[model samples]
Target: MTASKISFACAPVIALLGMAWGIAMAISTDHSTAPVHAHLNLLGWVSLFLMGIYYKLHEEIDGLFLARIQAIIWAAASLLIALGIALIHMNNPVGDPIAAVMSIVLFLDMILFVVLVAKSRQ
Candidate 1:
């Protein structure tokens, strides 16, 4: 599927998962994983959905290989960061390294997005 389609398809699923997670936390009265939930919503739902809309509006760049790469990387990194944060909250030492690396990956994905947007006609 196209990058835009992939984004559109994945965003809602991620959002639903995030919402469920939030509700679960609320029920359990444990907010320690709040950061992970926030990251899932922001990166998975907000950022992905916004990028999908942008791709939809700007057809010129929608089909570019780099756009697809950016979308995939963003999605993967989002999940990775959330997992890392969750693990850290669980007191796992490896979580720190995972979170650190994924954070950089997410940042680089955003940079790739910036380049794609800058190069696009619209």
Candidate 2:
């Protein structure tokens, strides 16, 4: 595998980190860690690697607007996820706005994923 693939593999590391952090939070009674850990796992790890794979194999996507839509959704999802994770970690109430944006980004990403899968099957 190339270095990019290796880097992609590290995405799961973030999920493991989230799990570890969650365990720590569970024992410590810290209110901040649960959401932060969840975001780290779901966004930092899973979504990031998924986006990279999406872009890398985009030819398989097979739609006129899919590329642009994927780009926008991926970028937005990454940015909002990072921002939301940070806000959550720092105990900032700004998470509401960040989460809202991330939610929309995730929705778009899911739609694109389904469309790409359907197209690839044809």
Candidate 3:
């Protein structure tokens, strides 16, 4: 499947998982990891869905290795950042470094996304 299809397909799955997590959190009465849940929904679900839509709309953006690389980096970084935030909330010192590095990856992914979209328009 194409990168856009991969992105679009994963979004709802991630969103459903996020919702289940939220419900579990509510039931357990432990909102300590709300940041993780929030990030999972926002970064994993919403942002990914939007990026997929962008790719779908811009046909000219297809077949670019950077687009696929961005998607891969984004998916990995999102999971890392969310997990890191959760771990950090639980007082794990290692979480900070994990999130910090992944944050940079996510930033670079965004920059690449913008550049790809811009180039597609040219």
Q: Which candidate number maximizes lDDT?
A: 1
Tens-digit lDDT track of model 3 for 1-122: 56687788788888887898899999999998898899889999999989988888886775567787787678778888988898899899999999999899899899999898888764
Candidate 2 similarity to native, TM-score? 0.55
How much is the lDDT of residue 88 in candidate 1? Answer: 98
Q: What TM-score against the true fold does each predicted structure earn? A: 0.97, 0.55, 0.92
Off by over 4 Å in 3: none
Position 30, candidate 1: lDDT: 95
Clashes of each: 0, 0, 0
Better of 1 and 2 by TM-score: 1
Candidate 1, residues 1-122, lDDT tens digits: the string is 67899899888988998899899999999998999899999999999999999999998989999999899888888888999999999999999999999999999999999999999986
As a whole number from 0 to 100, the lDDT of residue 95 in candidate 3 is: 97
Best by TM-score: 1
Which candidate, 2 or 3, would have the higher TM-score against the true structure?
3
What's the candidate order when arranged by decreasing TM-score?
1, 3, 2
